[model samples]
Target: MINKQYSITQAPNYWYDIMRGVEQGYSIKLTRNSEVVAMLVPAQYEQPPKQNFWQALEIFRQQVNIAELYDENVFSDVRDRCPGREVLL
Candidate 1:
C-alpha cells in the first residue's frame, strides 16, 4: 500500500485528496505533535467464522429467554376474535 503522512492541522484542507488516495489503496497516517494519531487505509472485507448447526443453536438458546418466549398471558389479549364483514366477491 502507498503510505503518506500528514499533520493534524493539514488534514482538513487535504481531506478530499486524502480520501481519494485512500480509495486508490493508499495508507494515510495523521500525526499530532509529531506523534501518529490515526491511519486511514483501504477497507478489507473478511468473512466471519462459520458455526455448525448445534453450535448456532446453542448461541440462539443463550440469547433467548425461555419464560418470555412461552408467555401465554402476554399474548392472550392481543388477537381480535370478532369475525369481519363478508365481502361481495
Candidate 2:
C-alpha cells in the first residue's frame, strides 16, 4: 500500500476525501510542522481478522496516548504555523 501526507491546514478541507482513500487502502499520514503526527490507515491494519494476544499488545504499545497526555484538538488544528511540503503519492 502507498502512503500520503497532508498538513494540519490541508486536512479538514479534505478530511472526507482522505477517509475515502484510507478505506480504499492508502495509508494517510497527517502532519504538523512537517512531522507525522497521526496516520489514517485502514481498519484491517489496526486489527487483523485473527491475531494473537501478543501481536495485539504490540499494536497497543505503538498507539498515541491522547486521552491522558494531550488535548484532543492538539493535532486537529487547521492553522498554518509551520511550512508544509508537497506529499505526492
Name the top TM-score candidate: 2
What is the C-alpha lDDT profile of model 1 across 2-82, one tens digit per residue?
489999999999999999988887899999999999989887523578899999999999999787778668778999888
| TM-scores of all candidate predictions against the true structure | 0.49, 0.51
Q: How many backbone clashes are present in model 1?
A: 0
TM-score of 1: 0.49
Which candidate number has the best lDDT? 1
- Scored by lDDT, model 1 comes in at 0.87
Residue-pair clashes per candidate: 0, 0
Which pairs, if any, clash in model 1?
Answer: none
- Residues 4-28, candidate 2, lDDT per residue (tens digit)? 8999999999999999999899999
User: Which window of 10 residues has the lowest lDDT sum in candidate 1?
Assistant: 41-50
